[model samples]
Target: MTVTPRTALTIAGSDSGGGAGVQADLRTFFANGVHGLVALTAVTVQNSLGVQGFSEIPVDVVTAQIKAVAEDMGVDAAKTGMLATAEIIQSVAKTLDEVHIGRTTDTPFVVDPVAASMTGHALLREEALEAIRTELFPRATLITPNLDEVRLLTGVSVTDAASQRTAAEALLEFGSQWVLVKGGHLCDTADCVDLLTDGSAIIELSGPRIDTENTHGGGDTMASAITSSLAKGADVPTAVAEAKRFIERCVMEAYPLGAGVGPVSPFWRLANPR
Candidate 1:
């Protein structure tokens, strides 16, 4: 007898460089033994150097794409990233609400707050942040935000562990059921620490720091990996743990492609299977 494969959906932007955005998400899902699906919100012109520009698809088209997937394939879990505009955010949120996706316990919604590229190029419209907070965040099963994004979203700076907790709490106030604070950008530490909290007990995930600038799609990969794990029946904590382990290996296996920053190896199993 054959078993059905789990399905994971990534509603995100497109990356011409193929290092980040929906491309990375799909790659991550597939690498984790998931059947990947996507609903594109925008198309980006970017590479290892930086993002040149991006153009958002119409709200109607984005909504239609999401509905097509939800009504047909019926995703086991979903991941959200790079919603470029207020209109797009609303469209994605409304579509998810209409389809009854990501609102239940079994099907998780993993959201990555992708506000900008690593080099400080803007990926999300400033106005879209408010839209996400009000409309999209409350429904998320988990929200993953790097330190920069956490500061931007909550206006809370991370000076230490307490400050990180404050920022995570502020995000929880925005209605995210759980918040994962990524500390890869914190240069003050010898090890990178990620904080996961659901307004209760906190789980601190730490890994030995790997010095590499090729972490272009690392955030997207983590969130997509969590979604894949959730679709495969892992709990939120287990899903996050699995994702963190995958990312550490990916960071270790990072390889440069161009003159600028490189991207993590989503398919680390191919090069270094464990």
Candidate 2:
């Protein structure tokens, strides 16, 4: 008899550039030894430089994909990214709720509050931001937000470690079981510091910042890594730490592959011949 690999699901938008969104999530899942499934919320015309246009998939189509995957292949863990509209967010939240009701033990949801691309193109509309805060955040197991997304969600500016902690705490009140406030956009030091808090304690993860322009989908990739780790039975804190370390290594060895901010090689761990 053969043992089948665990499966993970990504409910996100599509990146025509094949660098972020569902593409990045699936890459991370495969790299971490999970079969990847997808429920596309939108289609984006994007390149390494920027996103040019986007069209959201209808609610029915989104719902159909979720039901199809949840009913058959079954997911051990899941992550969401760039649900372009209020309707999409609400739809996904409901679908995840149904999945949770069915398989309470194996369902972990990682929510990446992706608002804009690295090139400054808006991915989620400003109005949809409120929908995520109101409808989706409460259902997520963990929410991963970068500096800009933290500001957008909590109306707080994170300029230092102290501010990051405060932001993480405030974000916890939004309804996620835990919050990871990414400090990559801060210019104060040569290290990237991220704060993971679950209301009581804060876990600070720091690593040497890779001085490279190839960070287009770092946020998406990190969140997916955490989801993959959790699907493989790691605790939340351990998963976050491991994912952070993996991302740091990827960044350190990042190669420029596009004219704009490029993608971190998600399969870097596999390429090591040692």
Candidate 3:
């Protein structure tokens, strides 16, 4: 019998706490049955409580890491998270452009606009946000931005489903092929709703919100799940729906591990196999 190999890449930061960032992304990928690769943009000192310190890897180093993996092993789909600086974002954007222009234009690229951690720790600076919008958004196959990130990206305050639709439209204008505006921060209901828009149509995913403080890396895990599914040949709506369900399950099964906001268990699917 022959084995088929499916590879996915995560270009993100590392969290020492092991709950979010590259760690969470890799775990999600593994749980979804895909081989995971990483390109570390920064190293974060964080636990369930909060981030203490962070240092970004230099641009050249980041580029080299990306090139080393992409040129040899190859990637079916890729996701990005927590680009700490504008320079790093630009570097990644350039490398991705090279890949998209040269080889695979249909390769899925999921971009998680990680502006801040759940504990209110600043992940990306203000200038870096603009750089991401201008440089990387256009290249991404999908951009996942939470409510706060949507506000930061477009200066539009999202409060309800209507506002979320408005925000999604504005984000679509930013040049991404698809925009997933996560409404986990909305204060209206006990249900969490997220909007996925591809400039032409809108898809709403809603589920009962899990009441837990372990929401630290939910966005990263969700986006990674979608990317992994895409790598496995799922369509956009199917991928987003599966990813949303995966995240909700993770939140429900969240364990208290840190002093502050805990981390979602990306392996919840495997741990509680149906």
Model 3 weakest lDDT span, ten residues long:
97-106
Predicted model with the maximum TM-score: 1
Q: lDDT tens string, model 1, 1-274?
A: 9876889999999988898999999888888889998899899999999999999889898889888988988889998899999888887887888887764545789889899999899999988889888887888999999999998989998877889888898999988788999988888899999999999879999999998878989999989989999999898899999999999988988889889998998877755656
What's the true lDDT of residue 206 in model 3? 94
Candidate with the larger lDDT of 2 and 3? 3
Q: What's the true lDDT of residue 130 in model 2? A: 92
lDDT (10s digit) by residue, model 2, range 202-241: 8889999879888877899999999899888888899999
lDDT of 2 at 117: 89
Candidate 3 yields a Cα-based lDDT of: 0.87
Model 2, global lDDT: 0.86
lDDT by residue for model 3 over 1-274, one digit each (tens)? 9776688889999999898999999999999988898899999999887889899999998888878878888878999999999999999989987665211377789889998888889999778988989888888889999988999999899988888999999999878888999988985688999999897788889999888777878899999999899889887889999999899888888788856777888777787766
Off by over 4 Å in 3: 2-4, 101-104
True-vs-predicted CA distance for residue 273, candidate 2, Å: 6.7
- Lowest-sum lDDT 10-residue window in model 1: 98-107
State each candidate's clash count: 1, 0, 0
